[model samples]
Target: MIRSTFVRTALCALLAPTLSCNMLDVNDNEDVSGRGARVFDPYQSSDSGAIRLSLQQFNGCAILPSGSAVSKGTLNLPGYPDTCPDLLAADPTSARSAPTGTLRLMAGTRYFLNQLTLSDIVLNKHTNGADLTDAVRWMKNESRFRNLDWSDLGRVSDQWTFSTGIEGFSQDAWTREVLFDNARWRTVKDDTFTVEIIDQDGVTPRMTPVVYSRTDFLADSAYGGHTRVGWRMETVQAPQSPGDVVPHPLPVLSGQPASPPAYRTLVKIEMVGSTNPFKTFEAPFIPGPAILKVTWSQLPDEPFFFPIELVTPEGLAPTCANADGQPVACGFGVDPKFKFSTPANGQGYYEPGESFRLFLDMRDGDGNQMLPAGVLPSGKDMLADKANGLLYATQASYFTLLERDSLPAYMVAGPLQKLQVRSDPQAKAPYWSANAESVGLVDSLATLSAFPGVYGSTWTTRYSVNLPQDAEPGTYVALVKTQRYFLGERVAKTNSYFFQVGQQEPTTYPNAVGNCQLCHRGVLSLDNLRHGLGVDHVEACKTCHQRDSDLVPRIQTLIHQLHNSSPRYTQNKTDCTVCHLTKESALRPSMNVCQSCHPSVHGDEYFATQFSAKGEPNRFGNCAQTCHAQSTTNGHILPEN
Candidate 1:
């Protein structure tokens, strides 16, 4: 009998295209509705007195005629286990009432529904009883309507109220607070009783009153104070479903991708001086100056590839100019003051993101060499600490030697000593010059080097060369060299700077106008239902739909006057959608799909609304009658001939 029933059902399905179910649940008792059938016990074995069907015959069922004979041996229904779990029937009574107050809804449900209803009520009241079809149309077009879920509504501040009791006898307490502790409710209007009920016990029940309130939906708060950018809500938790894991593993490699070869640029050089005559000279043999130390710190994050070549300028040899302005040329002696070039070469490559240092050695005119006092000789390399109170060094090789015998030695010294004395009665000499300027080293060097035939007085100057957009991405070493003139030759070659250049990503909408998405994307948290002059729609429209020169001043004055007028004024509206639409509608205004009621506020009208098109009307009659009727003479009256 069951096999015959299955055959009959299959024939009915094939002959009448109205039936949609692929499997029938014979064990279930639920009535089939229209052409739909309830599938029950779909896993029953064919040999257990059920339909013993062959795969080929079953597949050909749709092609067979209603009265055709079934080839019993060829008919087959594969024994594959069902992938879908059995679905339980929903309670009829439970379906009539709203789902549990605790049931969370998808975002934007409460806001969209509330706004739609409120807009309808406000429009009807202002339009002198105009039908609510337009308002309904707008709500249906809203983007959030389709995506809303139960959880979203549950999160609304005051989304609950009392309705009739389930059995029609008792009073049901349906406060939103009972459903959600955090929910808040604000009464929009006084409660009104809608219907009375009678219970199964034949007792009469009092009528229940209906009330309305708007919900405070949760929104992302991180961008609350940023008026120029828009923010969207994101889920804080990942999906807990077991099947959500990725099946494929991420690729792993041992090394980074090969980058293009790095280019080289020169960094600057620094020179330092050792002991002075006061610290090194004895009673008879006048001690010359000490050693000059030169060092340089490579750019912060550049790779060093080439040797730093220090090229000293021609003949103006390195010399010490004493207080009497006489030059003492200290040649290749243990601490000669004359300048010499040093080649900077090292084997190791500088890491792409690390900083390094380079150092140069030189002697003073009197052949006195300076001992490395800090990190250099000790190999501690503390050069990165700029505030460590160590000796100051510069790119240029410069220094001065003062007479240690001078105490005001000018008055007591002999003629030959005086000729070589180099004393400045008004000047305290080299060491004192260090204290004369705010920029300690630069100023001191400039001051001490004011003497004739002396070139060790000042440090080299540096200038920055800005990088262009098309410049290569890899690091380029920049070397700065400067020269100083002594009696005749360029004695010093100074070098400084190790740095990297970063490229900025190009903008996709470089010419985009005002931050329209700031409010349009629902990031501003304003009352979505409130119609206003500066709402997202109007703000976006103003981007391209600017008024003409002749009309701009007038429109501006009119708009400002309208919004600032008396609150009771009937015609005081300035919303921009009154005259715009996807296409013109006989009953209501549209801004095209772009300016449609929701989803996106941009569409075809965006291109058409440009100032060059001059498409928008100049006068405010239509807009005032629709959205700004409150500012009109009759306040809420529709236009009359």
Candidate 2:
């Protein structure tokens, strides 16, 4: 197969010079770029940003190849020893040389990086053969580069600048690039640099270079603020165009070629400097959970350097403290499962005009309160705490209450009722900044309520909401979504709880006939449901997708139509058991539900003729009790599994 691929590629190459070998990559397949044209936004181009490089070289100075030197004495560049030995110490002659390489820069830093922006920006455009790795696949199809596209390709703040004030870096200084619209990139860690060595042929591996800064090793203390480092790659041979044909001997049969093509990508560091000088002495560290201390030096032969300063202050590390200025035990950020506890509370019974309170807590994986009940990181202490690391610094929080119904309905009817943010009485001011012009403080907590503790991770929050005068008497789902900055990355947590109004033990719709989690897990979780409301279950879907949902179809009708057309539903879509766990419970005869699968049943001719004997104008009445009661299960087939 390898030989066949090589032979085919070689054959295509041979015929390329004289003829248009467009079939080499077979363009007859679906045009991926064209298919995605309607949604393509020119401004959404990921590589639209650029970075500039200015190499700093002091001639006659005994600088190490790593771009570091101590008053000039000896110069070493490995394999090229004595390259600049016995250099003058006071040599002031300096020249900046623009080396030949490709400078690559990505937008945003780790702390502020946004995945949605990264998802849109694709770094590599090549998509032929092995290069077609990033192409989207159907259900259960795993690609080797599954996560390659989701890397921290931060949105470039401008055409040139990118910030480095990430998790481990200081927030004092940032490049000129303004972080508008919540755009972000990956945080810069100590070993974030991608360094590679190549042979003369450009296809062979060489030795890795030691990367460091002029003042000290590439540590957290050296990388905060506006510190920036640009990367460049120099290949031995220029990149070959897809249409270019390379002359090579024909390959032997049985997947063996005379010479297999290889590539050597040598990373060359051309420039390393700061966009601006450091301004503050405070750097954010995660206390004992994520402390960073640099204790390394650069080698004389290493060929890259950035200037970093060690900020010194008494007790620079921020400790978790209570509002009374006493110390407390705490960690860095919220856990993936931040909504630790939300009891049913048996508060299902409520009067139409009466109000009810729902309580919940947002905790970390270690069962620690999101924010200390009595302890608060605010004012100068908050700043000092953030200089160490932030905890529960919410960027935004949304609470949506939806009333349940036997059938889906529009918002005005009875589906969506309320949307609130700060509902807890103890919640003081808004912790997030909704203004595009303002930057949110990294130390603000989501809920500062000092509510009494119940669970080990108790940070209980109370949500008070009143029922409408004509409110329905069924279950209500309250979705609480909180977005915050944790260890420099913007993370979100969503929790949904069910309660009743004007009823004893709220009733469920039983619309969730199937175990949808079988397919909708992990990356394909229900968070993608209905504009990302974090509705993790199919049952929660009925709240918004009502029978009178205005522009959208009902949940039952929508699910049937969606799965029928979905390419991922390889199983017999019409099979009742695929979605319906039990036929007797879910397979009720209803013209409204059946027409979603068989639209022909909605016509006047079918309804009139089919129900002529029954003497009915339309089949809107009791569908099962009339003619189709027993026949409802006739056409449906059961799955062997």
Candidate 3:
């Protein structure tokens, strides 16, 4: 196979210099880039991740297809069904009532008690030849790898920042609170995620979890805001850990010729300063979750210095500049000082036929205040040199408000109704800047609006809006988007001001058993839902999801693809009852949503291929006429076990 791969590559290089070969990797059956691509030689790529049967291997024929045939197993998930039958029978009709009543809300952090995690993984690899030894399978927490304890290692934020330059965090431990999003706090106690390493030799080895913890793995401080920790790896020499901290047992990613999965986040950190930690290695670069993968032979080796890099969620890629062309400060946003003054977000309200006051005070890193429409700067100007072009310019800037269906805490926010834009500069109040000509919104709402100004060194603005009698009696969020020019680049920032209308009917978001913790082992990333939103309950998700989306699949289809590929589902598929609350009783009598996840039950080759290719299942729940076939076959009225 290796020789064959090379023959094709060699011929391509000689015959067409411009054409490169994408040789096939026999192990994973994936394409390996050649020459200009990753892997230059085919043999070198194949031998890197070669999964040969160990002469002392115990498990035989442990790969997909052969292993996938095993009966559907069950994980002891809390509040979820243990067996398929129990799940189908758990009725949620009584609890699935539409929110009838409501209550009032104030602005603040709505602490959500979310919990979830990855279930135990089931190893099912195929075995063709002999030489089977006790093969080891470890799902190392790629997110966490520690050396000495946290106290000894200190906090991640204590010394690390973007200014550390590239390779700043080469091989070090990151504090938990600073690294992991608040959503992931519950997943790790003392910044650790442990998965039992399974050695499935004979009859399924006892459940073993490979622990990923911080050097100072202990109870979170009662004072709050504790740090999560993990170590970085260098390839120069082996890794060395202090007496208290140690490395994880996960395998290392070798220089395989194949391109890793898109899910595998990799960054090539050019080593800076000294490679040896014992010498002087100030962990440069952004600190993130490391991918720890070691070879089968290197299990017992100490001072583990295998090359390491961080794994970031989709949008958190560490780049100097991002897709939007904006320069990246660290892995997130660029230079912009963020602060909110009066009428802070998640507060303020408007009732029908009633007027509400909207006051705003914001400032930029340059300490220039926000002026209303057409205001000029008074002090330090960062961008344009002209009167309006350089200073606090508001002629092109505006603030828009959306009539939301509900508050941001419980439902998909609006693209619903937009308030009228005030066209006049009749604003109330003073403003500040280097050039203070005149200021006000391009369009402003009625009543005591603030005129643009650059005086008193303040970015103050105000508005009074009177709601019509026919306005929807719901919630509204006013987003004040201000724009400025910094060094010839456009810089923008938005401030959210949430308010409710008359007779506010307050209700709690409905996220019972399907709490994220039940699935993610207690980590939920609410980045980029509805404009980077996160909701706690089902009712909130239904507002935008349960329906059609211009950019994403409907809730049903999205759920299928998300869970179907999740690590938890790979172990057991019957745990659907965990993240869902749709009662069987609530479902249409003639509808069976089971096909959403169990499309394989269709039995027909065409039906199987068609839907799987769609990357989702029958979300509308008309399996009866899917292909001139009934929802179920034979006498199986309910979903099969």
Query: Residues 128-208, candidate 1, lDDT per residue (tens digit)?
Result: 111323332322333112111212112111111112221322222221110111111111122111111122122322122
Q: Once model 1 is optimally superposed onto the true structure by TM-score, how far is the C-alpha of residue 400 displaced, in angstroms?
A: 91
Estimate every model's Cα lDDT from 0 to 1. 0.19, 0.28, 0.23
1 against 3, candidate with superior TM-score: 3
If ranked by TM-score, best first, what sequence of candidates would result?
A: 2, 3, 1
Tens digits of lDDT, candidate 3, 575-641: 4444444333122211123443453444443332222211234223334445424333332232222
Stretches off by above 4 angstroms in model 3 are: 1-348, 352-498, 510-513, 521-532, 535-539, 546-550, 569-572, 582-596, 600-641
Which has the greatest TM-score? 2
Local error of candidate 3 at residue 624 (angstroms): 11
Top candidate, metric lDDT: 2
lDDT, model 3: 0.23
RMSD per model, one decimal:
44.0, 26.5, 29.5
TM-score of each: 0.13, 0.30, 0.27
